[model samples]
Target: MIAVPRAQLRRPLLSSVLHILSVLFVFDLVFAVTSRSLFSACASLALVGLVAAVSNAKYESLREPFVFTDLSLFSQLFSHPRLYLPFLSVGKVVAIGAGIVLVIAGFIVERPVLPGSRALVWLAAVLPFALAFPVAARLPLTLDPYVDQCRNGFFAVFVAYLLNGLRPATFRRFREVVAAGPFATGKPIRCPDVILIQSESFFDARRLGDEVAPELFRRFDDARREAVWHGEITVPAWGANTMRTEFAVLTGTESFSLGYARFYPYAFVRNKIASLASWFGRCGYDTVAIHPYYADFFGRDRVFPLLGFARFLDIRHFASASRAGPYVADASVAEAIVAELEAADDDRPRFVFAMTMENHGPLHLEQVLPGESSSRHTLGEHASWRDLTAYLRHIENADAMIGRLLDHLRTSDRETVVCFYGDHVPALPHVFEKLGVNPQHSDYFIWRNYGADAPERRNLAAEELGAALLRVVQDHGNRAEQPHASEKAT
Candidate 1:
């Protein structure tokens, strides 16, 4: 093989350096108006840009040569292509004009056109690229070169606004893209009496041995007598967005149906759902929803009604009753359920979907029960271990609450079926680190909770859980009919 020339090697390196410098300059000009210091702005851009470039380059190298034609991204984009028209109109015209001006200005401002003289020109180009890099990187690599170029065009316009230190109108457009979707709509199916309890951070911490709360394990054992107990449920988020899981269980659709790669119940789902409430409502049942948190906390005010609830009892309704940190206790929510059962005017059966909030997050043993040494006794000094213990204690509190509800249901004369599951796992980053648990494992607990007498539990998506629940209800209905038929034949 012929030896490579030094000039060729220098050419690519020089070009890359110039490209980087150009990106930096544009970034500086844009940031400087607000930052008030050119040097500081340029320095910040240089640092951030370099990191981003290296990351992008590494990511690009690992992938199969960035094929630019894949229907999936295009399909997603076109599914709500109307959302992008406004951005396209403004961005295309403004970005092209600004880019041309910056290129021309660079040639005029820098004298001699040599390495030193062209410094300002390089800065102008680099700064714009630095500012727009994130947007560019997020674009699918499988798009056509022209599509990538168009994305750059939008970035340029966005940068012009950034330089002027003005927020872009594109923010609203993004919200519209996320918001586009039909609300869940389907003919409802009549079902048996339904009770759904979303247990707070209910995962199996027994693997951590004595580090778990004693009351929690005791309550878990107690719950098994009357209800099916799934050992560990893998949840998506540790301490937040529990409603997303609830939404999935209520609606028989996955995150993909709402055009999200991840679970985001509040953002994607907007329509009335064929939930247990809706189904029971069609079946001549009185429907109500209970949550100890704010009525509006996950847009539940709008969503619960769509899910077929006739009424929702939230924190405002329970203002005088009981208190847990930042929310009404689970016990209070249980009372609300009992109250709804008693108050139903319709002769139809009642279906109540109650969410417990007493065991809400920052699940460190200390944050949950302050100044209480009994809560602290089970957990140890190790930060990694203590979190698991705290999570168990939280679960135990939820378990005890469930046990109380179950006991009440048992004593009551009305026939009721209570289905309880953890929404997601506790938000313990350290526990995840120790257990090597994948976030994807969040929906896996359905398998553990399925009893031997119960139907097989397959791995399911969050959105699919509602469908599974429907099937369970259907099975219960079928079994109920079988006995009735046998008695008639005898």
Candidate 2:
């Protein structure tokens, strides 16, 4: 048998060690500006770099040989090579000046920069290679030079700016992009009294399993036949931005469709919006909007007027307070709606829009029901299953409130209609990873569950919501007169 060369045996290990060191070195240089301690910074960088490298190598083989350009490597290594020059070198002078400033600041501040503190900065600088190595190892090594150049150029500049400071203009431009306004046609469809309830994080999480809030699912089934329930409606922002969803639904426009209204109440101040309330006001319906939160949270005080509501009732207007999570309870908000409806002038039909706030954030089972004695384990605390279970319990509470509202409407002399749906999905950041659901598959989830006499199937957006709701009112009116038509036929 031929003897294997010792060099061959050591080559793979040597390459890995070099690769790890290179990654750590890059991290050290970038992080040194903040960390100041060379050893600690280098050690921290090595740990993170090793983690990334090993993880990538484990997932992807590193045995593949890749060709690279000499010029590209030279430029990368000597990004500021003049620092090594004797004198009168521009890059060297700049580096020396920066070092002097840091030294002075260190002495003045009297606090040494710690190891992990600047690790983020250093990691930011080397992130391009850290990101690219895995991809390159997984895919073919062709065009590696161009990839490295582009990644370094783009990401390095980004890191530098991030370390220094970002221009306010960047935020302004982003606001300009996201803050567009009046995303709909802005035309009113003449319809009967409109009742819109902005339910909190009201997604149909039941798709994960059959056991989540079974009673709530049954209630949804009943509500579908009683009203025009559209499933698969998309909400813009996930956790917060409640007002943006409210603005879109009320105005019959996507918040981002118009180049200015995407910033919520700020957009309202800039543009005159003819909302559902304004449209109903024109048709002689008494308009009122209610919320169970503090009035100033989203500048609802100013925004409601822009929507043409004659009255805006908030937490202050409620007679009794119920707590759901951090906000006023859905039950209390439902009770307040009844009072508002009772107090409205009987001559004109009323249009009422109310929002529930009990189902907001953190989603700890304890945060949800407060005094309930149910085992925390049943709620599934650390796991996605538990978070979802807790969320459904809150929905059950909201459903109970809806049941009460429906009972009250049944007894009232006025023919009242109710339209309610979720504002968006709950705040489970790990949901996509934990549940194995695709984020892009948001359109698949339906608000109205599979049931009898529901619309064949559809995805709902803010613009489509108004018309769907109008159809419900029309259907209700037609049903009310159906007995008379049967008698006439007889």
Candidate 3:
């Protein structure tokens, strides 16, 4: 028998306690940033760890369900830090670093983070799941509606649910979901090239006639006249949450069906379901997703493929000289899309989904003094509306981008269809209060170089826009049996 000193045994125990406290302290502080209460954050500690692990992998800023759904996205972000490192906040970088330090300290320091012996780090890691049992689910009372007195014990319940999903009885339902049908069902039309512009905060402020000068929206007004389908769209999110609109348009999934996933659809769901891209892929169109930002933003880099995009053109794909203000200018994006269309001039149909980022939030800009408002533009006194003025300037630039894109498509010999819409309203809290603008509704216009007249302006949901766009595409000779060189692999 081996004898151990009391001092050594006591020291290790104290170290273990301190270590656990430190781990809790770090996560509680980190999770507190977004969680409503510290208790809720602590209760979801394991969930926090799971989110943090994925966030660290993807160079992402936050750890909502959207960022945690895919580990592969993290690996993609890790492989190309250059694309996203600059986008992360200083606080996020520090917190992530601190978490790593604590994790390493657990293995070597005074005590392990796990409950058992300090030397058994791996066993400690598995202890929580190993200890969770079915009997705990039968507890008499519960604090949270979903779980019993145990919080991390929720993991055991989750495991049970997962196993239940994999049971023989549920196999038929799983197969049914996987074997879904097509989107564009009409006579397999040889579709014309499709271009969808998810413009950043590009709405016509002219609607607020009293608040703005008519001259300010001249370019916006000019672009609207060319639309085949013009109207306002009620998006899922109010001021922000771009993914909600993106998901709705890509999959044409109704807002009510999204539930909690509405906030970040890119993260929560991992099914190989049919979408616009999948439908386009089936028809042999070259599907491409273009966005002037980090490839991993919202895990788009990984999700695009699942959505059936054959290629993705991100910020790295754009030249540095193309930048205007906070991001690659809309004009540059317009040029890039045209260039791709021209490059694939071999007559193969193309479907390009381009997301613009020139007008992102934090609209703090130089204040125009009381009387110094530019006489050239008619936005009341500009100094007080510095942010609004800045936004309008970006919108002006976006209008130019729209004109360029439409002009290119019009001049091209191959028939084309384009849908231009804003993802959501700008999160200008002050502006929203001052102007009484309904940020819930955004503007959208579908334009084709050559097509029949569209219905008068009408209101529609974001999810309903794709089906409408497809109906228009079918009319304009969609699905041109020609194969795009870029998508030869498919």
Candidate 4:
């Protein structure tokens, strides 16, 4: 048997422990700018690691406006890194690189944790401090919510991770909530066709309670006047996390009931539970979802099918579609909706969930004409920048798409109910900060091409929009034989 020096054994132990501390400090320093507190830093680092593990894309602090999101909501971030990596802050880039290096270094230098070792004893002793953190949270220096999390570095954040693991939401509870709510007792509509448009960043910027030129949202205002029932729906997200709003609209399930799963619904809600499409399917409708982007983006290719859509059409099928900026133009998406309707089997009603990507960001990438009329909607300072001008132009395109879709439906013989809404406000900090719109609110309107008096707009959450739509279509199904387009035009 070979004899090893005691000093050699102790040195390796020391190096391993020091290596762990050095790695954790990297995370602490990186998170200090955003978290500022021990618990938040621990949570943020853990989340970033999880995302890096699941998706190769780097987190963009400057472009993405979320820190507390779950893995499900981040699938879009996994898209070709070329689209997002350029906007990442330098500190975040270093931190992410360091985090990846540490992860690699961990495998190289790591030793198996022995149950009887001093490291285990130390871990056992310090873990009790998990309770002490909350108890000492009342004291200023010890908890240090006001100071940067780098103050405590490893111990406080480690303890925070331990404490957070104590409580987690279960799928069983999620099922109970879904079974009781969106799945409970709503009659399916008899309408021949129902089109729900989760238009990307399609809200009225003027609602920010800020000054804008009267004609800034000319096309949107025109649609509002023509709508039969329109309202202000409080969507699930703010600047980012399109999945949250989209999920809520399809399922009619609020994020509040989902706990941590709310941040990443796909991770938890995987089954074909009763959703808007499922409800319609039960009523003899062939459901189809159209999103003019990569199929796997935000896991929509998987989730939409599970949500009971019989068919899903993504970017691959739209090879001939025209582009406005980074994505297919919303006008082409509108034309696609008409094409889907025209191609649908005449035997059954159709439920079309059209999600447009024309107005999707980072708007900074777009090139816009200098001093265009849409320039008035920008923050006076950022008026010359690409982000503001690009968003204004993109949403203007989205407005035109809405008009095109309505025009086609208006002339068609079949009756259709169209529910249109913005997923969330664009993640434009300069514009939003100056304007002061409740970032959670987005505009929504329900329209039947046949025409009805536009109702007063009211506040709504995305989860409630589907039910509101159901009520609208179900309450007034089977209208009298309508006149031809030529007669109606007259």
* Candidate models: Cα lDDT each: 0.49, 0.52, 0.60, 0.64
Question: Residue pairs in steric clash, candidate 4?
Answer: 233-460, 234-460
- TM-score for candidate 2, residues paired by index: 0.57
In the range 268-368, model 2's lDDT, one tens digit per residue, is: 24334566777677667888888876666566776678667898888787646868655678888888888877877767778888888888755543433
Q: Which of the numbered candidates is closest to the native, going by highest TM-score?
A: 4
- Error (Å) of candidate 3 at residue 23 is 14
Q: State the lDDT of candidate 3 residue by residue for 146-165, as single tens digits.
A: 23202322223223333333
Q: Estimate each model's TM-score.
A: 0.58, 0.57, 0.64, 0.74
- The segments of candidate 4 whose C-alpha lies over 4 angstroms from its true place after superposition are 1-78, 82-84, 95-169, 183-189, 208-216, 373-385, 435-438, 477-487
Tens-digit per-residue lDDT, 360-445, candidate 1: 65444244334343553454455556555555555656666766766666555454566677776555655656666534344222
Report the lDDT tens digits of candidate 4 across residue range 381-422.
Answer: 444445666776777787778778877887787877889999
Number of clashing residue pairs, candidate 3:
7
lDDT value for model 4: 0.64
Provide the lDDT at 392 for model 4: 67
Which candidate, 3 or 4, has the higher TM-score?
4
